[model samples]
Target: MANLQLAVKGEYFDAMIRGEKTEEYRLCNDYWNKRLVNRKYDCLIITKGYPKRDDFSRRIDVPYNGYEIKTITHPHFGDKPVKVFAIKVKLTRSNYVAR
Candidate 1:
């Protein structure tokens, strides 16, 4: 299987790197649905912003535990709850696959 590449930055990225965050959320829209629906990913290639391809320190290769569609209320979604794809990930010392 291949990897799902995600561009993230700031707090979210740092949280994942520090093992404080274990999941990522994607809005349930056409764009995300097309990329995530019916697709099987081996892992999540999380990058901080648009870093160089060789910048592993700014990238995190974490395990793709699973994913599910759930309705939830979040700051990004305002007051109304919306559906989102919750992508489960597991970060660890060995997860950063050095090339």
Candidate 2:
């Protein structure tokens, strides 16, 4: 299984924790698309924090929640119709710590 790290806004993070959101969408990017596609299962650690300057690292070490990937969709971005990755997930654990 692949271990993936994600950063989400506070509101969306709350929804995921509350079991209101079952899917997450990521902006279409080469790195993200490659990592998320063709995976049977992925372990996702969702957090509410800003990523570091490098754009991949997060400032926070603790995760807000964790999930397992159930399905994935690669859809066109918009008018330009670029591809983007969307994942359907199921909450497996909650590690939310109010900050």
Give the per-residue lDDT of model 1 (tens digit) for 18-95: 778877889999999998988888888888898887777778877677688999898977999999999887876676
For all predicted structures, in order, the TM-scores are 0.85, 0.52
* Separate clash counts for every candidate: 0, 0
* Model 1 local distance difference test score: 0.82
Give the TM-score comparing model 1 with the true structure, all chains together.
0.85
Best by TM-score: 1
Candidates in order have lDDT scores of: 0.82, 0.54
lDDT of 2: 0.54
Off by over 4 Å in 2: 39-42, 50-83, 92-99
| For model 2, the run of ten residues with the poorest summed lDDT | 56-65
> How many angstroms is residue 37 displaced in model 2 relative to the true structure, after the best TM-score fit?
2.2
Query: Worst 10-residue stretch by lDDT in candidate 1?
Result: 90-99
